[model samples]
Target: MKRIHAAPGTISPVGPYSQAVISGHLVFTAGQIPSLGSFDEQPESFKGQVRQTFANLAAILETAGSSLSHIVKVNAYLTDPAQLEPFNEVYREILGHAPPARTTVCVQLWGVSLEIDCVAELIAKENGQ
Candidate 1:
């Protein structure tokens, strides 16, 4: 069976989807944007937007009993190819020590510059610790 997770203090999904779902020991998160819990407060700059997006991702992950450090894979979408490096700068600041495997692609997004989704193991099961 699968369990759904919704982080408190985060923006609710605008569509028909849960924030994250846990099946077995894995948690799958929906693509997160840079709204920072409110569409009205979305950041304007690229790096700022990236920070907010990660913050959103982190919240959902924590709610699912996982964390950034426990992620096993990630999929990132970028509106502009030039922003990858800037995004990585923030990524390194947060998850750089032992970042999860990730695949990033350039694509067009509406109202946001980037989006991110990830798959992670529950914290208690991380590295069998």
Candidate 2:
């Protein structure tokens, strides 16, 4: 088992929690927000915020020997119900055609538009070791 700190180019966790954890073939990620662990200067647009959040998520997953394509489940939190369709647009663009199973809900997010976390399988080597 391994605990992951923030990856390069990603925001560090501001509290007492790891960015992700690697256990056997799975990687469980912490909720990723748009900022670099700060509440100031959050993206003004919903899509922009979503993109930044995913970027942070991808960085941590990669550091855990996983990629976005390896994700098996996702839990997304949105602060606005009206942004669901717009969020889906960006989600499709980034996650591609076959996205993982997901559960998204509108919630009260402090100083941010959204938060995302996921569980992903580790990418295997070509040798399948």
Per-residue lDDT, model 2, residue 47, is 89
Pick out the ten consecutive residues of candidate 2 with the lowest summed lDDT: 35-44
lDDT of 1: 0.87
Off by over 4 Å in 1: 125-129
- The lDDT values for all models are 0.87, 0.89
Candidate that would win on TM-score: 2
Count of clashing pairs, candidate 2: 0
Name the top lDDT candidate: 2
Residues 33-122 of candidate 2 have per-residue lDDT tens digits of: 988556575678888989888888899998889999899999999998998999999999988678899999999987788999999999
Q: Write the per-residue lDDT of candidate 1 for residues 25-125, one digit (tens) a residue.
A: 89999999998658667887888988888888888888888898999999999998899899899999988999999999999988788899999998885
